[model samples]
Target: MTDAESPANGSGVGAVRSHLESTISGTLESRNAGAFVHAGSRHDPTVRYCRVALGRRWPRERGREVVAVAFDGDEWLTASSDDASGHPAETLAVRLAERSGSNTILTPAAVPHDAALYLERAGLDLASTDVVARARATKTTAERDRIADAQAAASAGIRRAASLLADAAIDDGRLAADGDPITPNRLRTTIDEAIVSAGAFPAGTTVVNPDPEHAPSTLDGEGTANDGDTSEVPLRPGEPIVLETAPRGPDGYHAGLVRTLVVDSDGGRERRAHVGATQSFRSAAAMLTADAESVTSVEADLEAEVRAFGFGEGDDVRTRAFGVGLEPCERPFEGGDRIDPGSVVRLESAVHVDDGSWLRIADLLVSSEDGERAAYLEAPSRSLEPSALLE
Candidate 1:
């Protein structure tokens, strides 16, 4: 690091701020203003927000990632891993224009906007921002690799959650194993401990009742139960248990796992539903093995399987499967997102019974080059029974 770039000590935030302030230099003011515009947080200081954003995107190598800073009263684009010093802003502008062609390009609208300068340097004109965003959405193999690892950790967490509930029964405000009730707050603490033992972060955990009348509600991913529903209620025989967990690595890659269990009962009706749902999950898994299949295609197949299993169309199965990455869920499998060769997704297929009987199982799915051999991190059995563990 140069004298101008030396980081401050004491706290991580301080060091980050120092580095950003120095690295950005004259561009800091403009970048800070842009940060506010993007964040839409009037109370948040622009400089602090810029520092945080940069910290999140900090590349391992100083010059490997692309970054734009206001420089010489203009926005300058540079890649620490590649073009560290960067060309004149006008040159980069031209390049951006050429890459976009008919698409529109966007630049920072805040303090030190110089997108026009970079565009001119690249011998191109500024276009629409949408086009540039589209191009950047595509993932690389390296990123997919990280995402796959994250999913593996997340799957491990789900297994741990299953173990925690193996003998758990909730009574009143407390959860019980045999007859003794455990407090509602203890549930998270216990589950979280188990998750750590299983080798994954306790990103989030929720064990809630599935409501038919209000079943159409969406999961915020934070695991909150809808309305006044009480997940803290006593666990009764024949009631369903939903456990969703996600774990992230230090690298920011993440994965998710969702498992639904019914207390100690695997009767014909319950077993049938579980079997059918598990089969549906497997079918989707099978389809994901192929690289040629897109996320939408996989979702369609999963839905079809659910329907074929005798479930009515009115029963909303909720989300099919989605991409898992840095944000717990990322690209490729997000709704409306396409699956590319380098994408990593999580496969979830579920069946809900009228009496709040639900069965959901999730696994990390990696797209394969063959379009027929997608990989999975969670190898739990498709049966949903204890005997089906790791099959």
Candidate 2:
């Protein structure tokens, strides 16, 4: 996290202030701007917000207020409860608005519905939108560092899983490690452990799909193979195992990694699909630039390449390019939003083979300033060579 006392020049807060100044003529109000504390515990977003807003962590010195307002005609005002009146945040905000003679305040879209109603009842006009999301989409140098740390942890987890797959003993068409059979549950646990040990938070559960037909179609779905009894099905040669994970570091930034590997061989179709997916990912990533064309145009080019490589329409092949930061899927690189320099995004491609299996790969890339090419954040080799996993 960046120092709170330091100026947030060109940071998300600055971006948000610029947006509000241009859009609204009144003051802006925010509440619960930090994380909710329960039993002496708080989440990372709250901590990060506090670091950004106050240059400090939570448990904010009780009477010291964290709520801030950027008044249109005046400078920014940051206040805490002045007295022991025990006033709620909304009440204080209402009082501030009335005192300042401002009728409406712009809030972020994440504000709860009840909060909105309360603000409305207090005679404060509220304009809510994804302002915070927009601010977060473009990361600061500190935020990028945290994300890179998280991505390193995610890569460690992936390498651990690959090592397990490569070293497992294949006996009677079953995979065994350390004299015990390797199940999806066990593998997921191992990956989580590796991630946590590598300085990341504990990943609740990872998607380990040894069966292509049973893999979740979307990236967000839960992983359940062999009817949720993944141990019942052992590893088989020539079968694709999809291992996908999104792990967050202690600082609360997430990095996503997805790789599909085969125990022995992937047959000809899987190899072709892998090649196509790789091509699609590289093509799309190459087009990501600060002043590049529209996302739709880049996507069209990627789809065309995939189709030309034999994974055409109705083959269930999909490609997505989006930002990755505090959240795995931050603001999408879509809707005509020009790619901003320093924006970290992921290019993902998943292709379903004729044998009812899936081949997928994803990589992280960051757009560069003028005259510079986009850089790869996580440069793990995408080679499908089985020997690479063993090494």
Candidate 3:
């Protein structure tokens, strides 16, 4: 490794702060923003882009990952939480934009007020153009690959969930493994282990809910509402268990996968709902495009597809698709933003059954440059039967 990228050098922020010469025209242009400023912790996309895209690294002691960063598409200035250089990370970050060729800085609303004041004090214009947000919504090929790798790990976690369900035996109507009633904590630990083994961090969250309709919502991929819900309720046979996991890859990209399975099913209402959810996934895959104008329209079609299968949609249970990447839900094109050609999305298809639960499946999806149709990054059976994952 080069000296700057090496962790042993203790170069701290200087290693990452480069004054590269680029064809930035050294003059303002009506094109993409010539300068961008962002501030967030390591999980933020700014750090990811700096680390992954720009091939930069922070010193080991200075690698706290939380930082205020500024860039002009080529040059970079950053200050981390570990900065002892007597310079405030936020102020240093905002000050660098003045040196950039651009007269204005494109920053999101999340900018720190103190740092923002630096721009104003320096007499530089501040444009709330969402430069970072826009770039994050549009994934480069490498970003998509990282997200897919994370999703593959996420899929492994879901597979582990299914394998556990398959191995559990019905003991007095409750799912049992090793003669102990399997609990949500056990399931979460197992799934998280599988995810880590597959080369991703389970930092996002792993949710194991026996009943999604009544369980706290996982619509945001955090499952924060159901922190310990249904922990005491032993999963019963014929009951549906929802496993939703969002794992971030080593490089800061993230992906989500959710699956619902039943142990020792009776082949009744649950089966129908499972089929409806699975079919909706297949149908949506057949229609998605890389440049879909309105993702909401595509989501509406999946809702209709689920309704056609004799399953009723519940107000609490939603069937939809949204962008996924640097965050579990990067949320692209939802607010009239154009769909990025290489963006990754999560397709969630769900149907509510009379059994007081909602059956659902979610997987990472992507469309090719051909713009014909989208497809799943990983293929696992959506069957309600636990053994389907093994198939």
Candidate 4:
């Protein structure tokens, strides 16, 4: 890599959205969306593909999903409108499609009911497929670098957690620092502050409450750390501490990470779960190449690794992995979809050892086209030991 592209010397930040970065872009694939109108809010299932269809980023207001763009195979037509009475975006989209000599709207069946009425009233046929989502999942060079930057920021947060845990003391079978017991809330705050210090914004659910000593698992609502006082419990000694977070960079791209740690270990379930989790982590990551087949394959491999470690796939609560980018978990590779280069996916490997106790290790990975290797975006160590994490 050239010095100009080095992460330290040149931080490539702007790859997606800016300013009201909350205000994002509206886009739908025109390649296969021919003779169809593509319109939906960010809340739609297809809404996850809204920002990637066209090419670059545009502006989307916080609440209104009122932008529609259509390509008639020759020229481009763009229109946007807002109203309380009906779906103005859909109205404009259908009108533009008809103007382009087409009377059909190609959209996922998951589009909002109000928006669906616009196309149905126009007597246009609705195609029940998410062609826009299937069109492409590749990120440009700048976008990849931007995501890597966000991963770096997330790594900073993990480092902060590790540093704090390393400095804490085990007192009366509990983690303590500065004469006070180290709580999940304190660790989460430390991690979020580290992410912010590294020029990234912690999401509403940034740092999930880590697993304590006796009671291991505390994963809530896919990790809603900012929700209740679940993170107020003091950490236990010699148990798995799950430090998982997804933080967004200035460019509106997000990165995810999960690493477990055990303090003052007595070499019990913590060691066993960590060993299996680490192996599963590497095994799943190895399948993130451009030619990778499906997410199920990776998930199966991870499950096997943990199961081989003499653990059962804990009931309904288990581990999972998927694609990560603008949204924390977007464009999942389920349903036998092919992996494309330039796609960033997060493989979160969790091992449920017993009731209320689990161990997990996760990382952000970028696919490579050359078959050479996929690269990890975050640079934090996945050591289950605090001293190793300090390294």
**Whole-model alpha-carbon lDDT for candidate 2:** 0.60
Q: Please give the distance, in angstroms, between residue 204's alpha carbon in candidate 3 and its true position after superposition.
A: 4.5
How many residue pairs clash per model? 36, 3, 0, 0
Please report the candidate that would top lDDT against the real structure: 3
- Regions more than 4 Å wrong, model 1: 1-126, 129-141, 169-175, 178-187, 196-200, 204-231, 266-268, 289-291, 333-336, 370-372, 386-391
Whole-model lDDT per candidate: 0.48, 0.60, 0.65, 0.62
lDDT order of candidates, best first? 3, 4, 2, 1
Taking all chains together, the TM-score of candidate 1 against the true structure is: 0.60
Q: Which prediction has more favorable lDDT, 3 or 4? A: 3
What is the per-residue lDDT of model 2 for residues 1-391, given as tens digits with 9 covering 90 to 100?
A: 2211222334445443454343333223343121121010123242244345333333423433434333333343333334224333455455545565556565555554654565567766766545455556666666677778878887777788778877878878777778877666666777788887887764553677634355322222244332334344555666777777778765557787778877778368888888777787666666764365555665576667777777657777777677787667777566576557767777777777745477778777777766577777764556565457445
State in Å the error of residue 92, model 2. 3.6
lDDT per residue (tens digit) for residues 1-391 in model 1: 1111111123343443443344334332433322111111111123223423244333334432333432221332332214435533434444444444232333434423443554545543332222212222333454455455555555554455455556565565334765755332344455566545644455553333333332222232234433443434344545555556666544445556666665566475556666666666678656655445656778888777767766677875744666665455545554667665545677777666654456676766666664446666644454444333433
Question: Against the hidden reference, what TM-scores do the models get?
Answer: 0.60, 0.77, 0.82, 0.78
Off by over 4 Å in 4: 1-33, 42-65, 82-87, 210-229, 288-290, 310-319
Give candidate 4's total backbone clashes.
0
Looking at model 3, residue 94 earns an lDDT score of 42
Global lDDT of model 1: 0.48
> Lowest-lDDT window of 10 residues in candidate 2?
32-41
